[model samples]
Target chain A: MDLTVKIRNKTLPNPVGVASGTFGYGEEYAQLTDLSALGALYTKALTVEPRPGNALPRLVETPAGMINSIGLANVGVERFLTEKIPYLETLTCPVILNVAGSTEEEYASVISRVDSQNAIWAYEVNISCPNVKHGGMAFGTDPVQVERLTKTLRKLTDKAIIMKLTPNVTDIALIAQAAEAGGADAISCINTVMGMVVDINSRKPAIPAISGGLSGPAIRPVGVAAVWRVSRVVTIPVIGLGGILTWEDAVQYLLAGADAIQIGTGNFVTPDASVKVLNGIISYMKEAGFQKIEDFHGHF
Target chain B: MKNFGSSILNQKEIAIGYREMTISWPQSLEAPLPGQFLTVKVTENPAPLLRRPFALSGFDREKNTASLIYQLRGPATRLMATLEINSSIEVLSPLGNNFTLPEKDETPLLVAGGIGLGPVLYLARELDKNGFSPRLVVGGRTESFLPDLSNLKNGSIHYCSDDGSAGFRGTAVDYLKSLDWKELPSARLYSCGPQGMLNACHNLALEKNIPSEVSMEQMMACGVGACMGCAIEVIGPEQYARVCKEGPVFDSRRIKWT
Candidate 1:
């Protein structure tokens, strides 16, 4: 089956990839599945410096999903370049680095440092991370700020830049358009919905940060709707995510016009979710007599 | 660490809401060291999506079996408690780093409160096999909350209860203070319990100039360090460490107790 999907100049092996943060640095999950079979392996959100992240009680399970406030906990870019990048360079699949910063300059600086790396085929600009107190969701929520940051990053690297849009905004289509206007090659929609789980007995927040970004099955409808809405307004390729546990869910995103799909919290449920989704997609394709990934792209 | 399925051999309730579950282990897989844990999938369904991590309380090399002592804490554990015997459960084996074994000439002092005795019991068994006679101190809110240590060998057990129903009549920290400080200098302390109890143990070991190691608890999703769900503050240049990756057991000085 011809399962490849093209976003800008780079070609993904398939339209199935594991979301950032859910699939660590590719090193930890390498033994669990075949990395080459994946479309891409997205890394955890990395900052300019090492972030300690939030305190204890970082995670809490909700109705059909889980909440987490990891605060972009990661080893800095220097450490990533020195320690993690070398391992990522060895992987057969494309490594998409998710970069975050408090300011435009910080984002540009991180992109500049990593731009020269041959192993990293693309960049997923995490302009919308609700867990952090500063930056992240700030730039992504405003169309103007999204354009400025995306434009700044667009000037820094020729590599495919994916603007990971936040769903907290009033109109996600406006943000997606702004990202496209700023020369973004692709768009990844729905970076966890901002939600909270309270401890009824303690009368306090369950997660240490008081509130957290909710991911998993509970957020799937929201993510699919966001991707469907955003894909309509933007000409760039759309990568959809949120609560993608099965192959049928991945097909829903593909039918909704997502060029590719990323499995987020579902990775925690099954370590081999990406491969399983990929294999299932192939089976679905064969069963439906579809020849290529584009046969069902935005079919609905 | 390898991810595989282990069949249940036996499960028996030792206390109200507490069960001792023994699972079959193939001889091909290496036995887990003291502080390492297995993230067991209590259900195949996505409702309880994440696997629940449990410390290996005991292992029989020749019999090729392992046991986990757990108390019913939440929906996941409740599901695990109802799992019928002989049914295979998907488990990610030997996740996280293990507790540090003591050096020669150092006496191991093991401390645990409530269900924290899971790893502590395993450590004691390992110590005894190495020809070391370790001292164990256990505490609970009441006698019912404490584990039965009659099956364990080669350790002098000191018990303390908050309600004074059994053992001493105060907190575990208070019990530690009642011990002779002079006799603790040559001891290497290992503790696993509530945050307050661990903090107290850390301070007491510091005061006595004895080195201490503590096993920390954190809510986790993927026990293989992929999710970054279990972040713990460490007192070092790097402020955060994943409890699933860096440690479930760490030197007492490395943790930021606050």
Candidate 2:
């Protein structure tokens, strides 16, 4: 089954990639499933410093999904560079580093620190995070800042740069345009949308942080709509995510014009979620007699 | 410890071959231990994305199946309730660690609160099956919510309720408070349930000097060890330990209780 997807100069073996923040360094899920089978692996968003993250109740379960405010907790770039990057070198599939920061300098600092690593195939700029009280919304919603941050990442490294945009925006296409103008190689759209759940019994928030990002099957359609719109407007390839659980779900994204699809909430449910989707996509290609994953992109 | 391929096994009502739906490796699952829980990924919805974590009630030796018992808490739980017999529930487990079982001669009194039964029933059966006589204390708001305890045939079963609707009318703590600790002061104790109930038991156990273990429940992310999402400030030197790694179960004396 033909399942190759070309983003910039890189050739992905399949259209199924692990969405940022879901796989957590690609090694954690290694104990449960095959990581190499995925088209690519997206690491959790790493900041410049190790984060303890939000307090208790960082997550909550809704009808068909869960809301999380993990606050992009990571071991920071220095440690990730020293510890994570070395481990990543062992994997054959392309590992995309997700970088997030409160300030422009911090983002640049983390990028510069990992800029020399030849192992990394691309960098996903996490301009969206809702749990942090500061800077979470600064770069995500504004078109100009999205452009500025995307350009900054572009200048920092020759490694392919994919700007991740938040769905918590009035104009998602506008942000995608900014990333393109800033020279982003590709764009991964629709990060978690901001939402809050309150525990009616205690008169308190369900998630201890008062609010968090909503994800799961509930967010898939919204993600699909955003990716569909953005992919239509942008010339760069689009990596889509939200509530992608099955092979059919990935097809929806690709058909919605996403060049590739990332498995996010699905990963939390099943660690080998990426593998299932990838295999399913391949199986579908064989059954349908498609020559390539891209051959079916955006027709639906 | 082995990385099983990814795919969610649906939830279920019962397991066929085993008397009780004892999910085992190739049957239920491999990794999840007693205290460790597996996140049940519910794909039917999308707004909330993370899989819900449930303590393993038993171990599955078969790679093809996993066994779990859950109440109709919400959509996720409701979805799990309709699971067919022998149908696999997508699970990640043998998680956390089994409550440290006492030695051959050691007697442990098992106290389970409400649905807290989900995480402690296996331990109770293990002790009973091993000939380690343990008295089972099961508590619930009303007798109607009580899970079937006939599987625990080797032990004595006691029921407690808040409104005097059952065996002891008062709360489980009330029954516990009134119990004759003198007879079993030397017995090891294991308790799991709501924080309030556990705290009451914790104090009573300490006041009576009966060593006890309590399983602490908290929201989690990675379930393995990373993300630090399930940390508790009741154990280790720094007053913090991971529920997923260090324990969903802890020695009552070692925890801060809050």
Candidate 1, A5-111: lDDT as tens digits: 89888799888888999989987887777888889999988889888778778999987789988888888899999999889988889889999999888899899
lDDT of 2 by residue, B83-121 (tens): 454555444556677688777666677777865776677
Once fitted onto the true fold, the runs of candidate 2 whose alpha carbons sit more than 4 angstroms away are: A81-83, A286-289, A297-300, B1-33, B38-52, B58-68, B79-91, B103-105, B142-144, B151-155, B163-169, B179-187, B205-211, B219-242, B252-257
Q: What is the TM-score of chain A in candidate 2?
A: 0.96
Query: Candidate 2 overall Cα lDDT vs. reference?
Result: 0.75
The runs of at least 3 residues in candidate 1 whose Cα sits more than 4 Å from the true structure, single-residue gaps closed, are B180-185
TM-score of 1: 0.95
